[model samples]
Target: MNAASPASPLLEVRGLRMHFPVSEGLLGRKVGDVKAVDGIDFTVRRGETLGLVGESGCGKTTTGRCVLRLEKPTAGQIIFDGVDIASLGGKQLQALRQRIQVIFQDPYSSLNPRMTIGQIIAEPMFVHGIEPNATKRMERVHELLTICGLNAGFADRYPHEMSGGQRQRVGIARALAMNPEFIVCDEPVSALDVSIQAQVVNLLEDLREKFGLTYLFIAHDLSVVRHLCQRVAVMYLGHIVEMADSDTLFDNPQHPYTRALLAAVPVPDPDVEQGREFRPVKGEVPSPMNPPSGCVFHPRCPMAVDRCSKEAPQPREIAPGHMVACSEVKITG
Candidate 1:
């Protein structure tokens, strides 16, 4: 479902900006802002999956962290279920955390080596004061392990003893402990093997349907994003260049950057691949700290114009629900 629906957004972000100050000199005087996530906005609907995709350092992870209060936003309004979380402080922020959970990129790193799987899963319940009895917490831990396809006996084992896929299951079990309606999947399968990736993705889909959860699925891989996300947003240099339903964006990409990204994906058939008039993208990505004036992507864009160099294009809905931020979105015939 689209975020604009009056039923209300599970999570809504408006004019979100996360800038890191570049302090220089002996006195640590502010020189300039990194502009890591300079003024981008979007939303997550209740029980829906929204994928945030970009090349590395495009600020996808930063945006997710800002929304979850893992990192404080430099400026923006973050409204969660009608409550403005960005303006909240102290006890309120802690209370808000129970509703939002995060699954990190590396499962091995995320799971504590010292803690057993059961203890790891039950940690959130203990923090939230959800279970008073030790016995009850253990039971809940067993239930979670089972839900994520792990045997109850496996809970006694440490993270190191488990395979990459198993460790990830434990991670998922931990996230589910709080019964959170929303979760930030911060590239949950990026580090796993190819065989493991599909299983993890399928597990996520199963969990979403079973639990009625919403997700901000952050990833750099387009193939992964298309498989898991209902709607997709493509970010570039701290801004969303294009957003649309998965079918529309993948089948008929509007933005030049998106097209270039897709072109890099390998075609299944060699004959068709050989026939393709490939226009491989060139040039190194410009530094975000000292980004170009007009469009951030104009420097690397193949079909750049003089106007593109000087004029920044706002994201506009040229089609019914598809939005693009490019002066020219002319795909070859």
Candidate 2:
């Protein structure tokens, strides 16, 4: 695939919000909204991997879902290749699916038990009418299996017959089968064994380079994100609190939450790990249905001041391509 201009973004999300209505009683009267993703914005440059990292309920997955158009946003824009897809449906959305694909977190649940691996991978092609010929589809499946580091023979086996790592490789093959330009990897390796995680991550990295694919990689594992993504975005309570190049954000995190998250990552060396100051974030994440006023993180922020409780902070660029959303943090050139 030919790479798009390096400066042009393949995907751009602006003020994306997914607020699920909370209801009560059989009447199902809406009482409140669970703000899963609230007004977060970011861009994925063509052929670059952008990592979205946060706690389990911090809305990282929600953001990715909104981008995939699986959940309609309450209000915002999801631009894919310069077209707004947030409200698209029918044939248009179906057409968009051909260019964008997702590799889910759980390999066990994502694959079909009844379908053979060949059928599972070929299903997308069939739905999109990519390969109409039965022989050609099977041949394409074998090629994809080999590309994903699996033997072509595995195509005849069922999902129950493969190991977890092998199952995940099958999932990767399925995503690639679409010939997608962009992919959403929602913690693709999080369910695998630690040893297997590295292999899967490496495979994803290799595949991206080979195909010049763009990725919106949603993961909680900072180490994995650092290994695979060129840029990283840190989310807190439905908002992106910080973003920067992977190296810059990992080494010099500006937001309080970003700093705490990095601190929580365990160092492999005992001497370094033990010597490093480890302070867990003070409190549990607040409920998104009734998030705290002003900055949602103020309640848990150690550096929070009185103003942080009364005034929300918008993301401000402190340095080139490094944004931080904290009132207390000083901007440095």
Candidate 3:
């Protein structure tokens, strides 16, 4: 799949599906499948941060994994820089790893406790056949550590010796070691202290500008996504229900699901917040093994009609760049 054009998105996922089969019986015959990422589509433009936000188990993380080819999509096209990566194998796939990277959610378990910080960061460079010389690798490790706001001398320290925030910085350093053009930041700040979260977010923003990198920032924290992303895409039960620019989406959310999510956010002003309405999202998320027919969110959606429960809504542009998948949405200025 050649890139559609020079102005095409850096990463494009079309109809991506990842289904893990569930088997039961003496022979463990296939009985069901966990539809982790069920036919989702989105894109990340060059040098842009696209936020993927959703409740737990809504496939936000799974989508990120599919893009990185960590979890092979059962179906769909994962086009990176105009090449269809989902079909690549051997050296082709191996080479693609250097251009795309991931920073895991948990820093404690992500790094090897036995390895020193320098070795941890240099591992990717070595695997990619980059910075092969031992002396040069050490120098590059120090430079990456410094760039990620860690002390250069801490290269000799083990994972057990670092704080949570520090460990995350090392994780970031490792991801940067490959000099990737795109990164999957999978809740990179969720495990840190509130104060530390801000620092890490700021650092990511700075690094994006410095490296000219694009990011698929997956997180449940709306405020954090608002702070970091230029555009936001809301996922529900393996489908993107709404997508729009940060300011436009926040100010004028059209989908009922999107409205429900934004309504749950806490406002800072006591008096104004007290007067504002709060509509708790109704019903627990449905099981992905056998998700509801039609719109997955219709069961929990307050505004769902008979049609919503019978037919799936296709994405349609309501404004310049705002797209909503709910048929109930009425476009108005």
Candidate 4:
């Protein structure tokens, strides 16, 4: 794992919310909101990867999308490099896109099947008017392909012509084409095969070190998150239940949800796997459109009390750099 940077935050999300309006009828009248991302805050220090891990529909992807500005947020601020990008528009937003890039989850659909690998990687540079010379653009594309662990010859090939792993490498190359400072990797290796996942994850780690890149990595694979992220933020029903360094969160999880999540990850040792009891988190995830009162995870939280059903738990710093949103948890030295 990359060391956590002590540098100032490259990105800060404060009370960020993305509430999709639930509509009905031909007129599309709004009934309620699908609270994808409720009020939540976190930061990605320069050159550090912050993992956002949660169950499906917990708003991990939505939070990343809000950062990329793919979806306009319903509330809060996305402060990047000291500028609040939540309200940026026109040329300003367009310029910001160059600094922040995304590597999508699906390799098959994220790329243009019609374009060659070279064209795919070059498209971003072309749109942004980087490497204006045609020959230089092609050279840059070849260089990026090589940097992403693909053969330079692969540039002539189309998306359909390459394997799943190669396609994802192309996707990474495309993101790097913009020379971005921060990248939102939305499950970038989740779709690939197990062996391929390792290769891609290693590639990402190498690229981060080589280019000094910061990432907001969103994934459901706690194992991968533990390996790749320096710090982790656990989300549940649109709220961050826990946030801590990877080692601390995995080894000494305080929140009930976080403990359950770590418990769910299969241990590699056969003896331990057989001996350990598996206790999955009880209850299905609640609907975000109408979340329960008080703590969102109270229904499933083992440590929950009567007050948990009435008062929402604000995130409290229990130790230096470790935050938990549970009334039952105590501060530690």
All candidates' TM-scores? 0.94, 0.98, 0.96, 0.97
lDDT of each: 0.88, 0.94, 0.91, 0.94
> Candidate 3 lDDT, tens digit per residue, 1-333?
453443469988899998999999999999999998888788888889999999998899999988888887899999898888987888898899999999998999999999999999999888888987999999999999999999999999999999999999999999999999999999999999999999999999999999988999999999999989999999998889999999888889899888999999997799989899887988899999999999999999988999988999998888878989999998764
Count the clashes in each prediction: 0, 0, 1, 0
Worst 10 residues of 2 by lDDT: 1-10
Cα error, residue 214 of model 1, in Å, equals 0.4
Off by over 4 Å in 3: 1-7
Position 284, candidate 4: lDDT: 93
TM-score of candidate 1 relative to the true fold: 0.94
Model 1 spans with C-alpha error above 4 angstroms:
1-7, 330-333
lDDT of 4 by residue, 1-333 (tens): 244455889999999999999999999999999999999999999999999999999999999999999888989999998889998898999999999999999999999989999999999999999889989999999999999999999989999999999999999999999999999999999999999999999999999999999999999999999999999999999999999999999999999999988898888899999998998888899999999999999888888899999999999999999999999999996
By the lDDT metric, which is better: model 2 or model 3?
2
Alpha carbon deviation, residue 89, candidate 3 (Å): 1.5
Q: Which runs in model 4 stand beyond 4 Å of their true positions?
A: 1-6
Cα lDDT of model 2 by residue, 1-333, tens digit: 345587699999999999999999999999999999989999999989999999988999989888888988899999999899999999999999999999999999999999999999999999999999999999999999999999999999999999999999999999999999999999999999999999999999999999989999999989999989999999999999999999999999999999988998898999999898888988799999999999999999989999999998999999999999998988987
RMSD, model 2, all Cα superposed? Answer: 1.4
Measured on C-alpha atoms, candidate 2 has an lDDT of 0.94
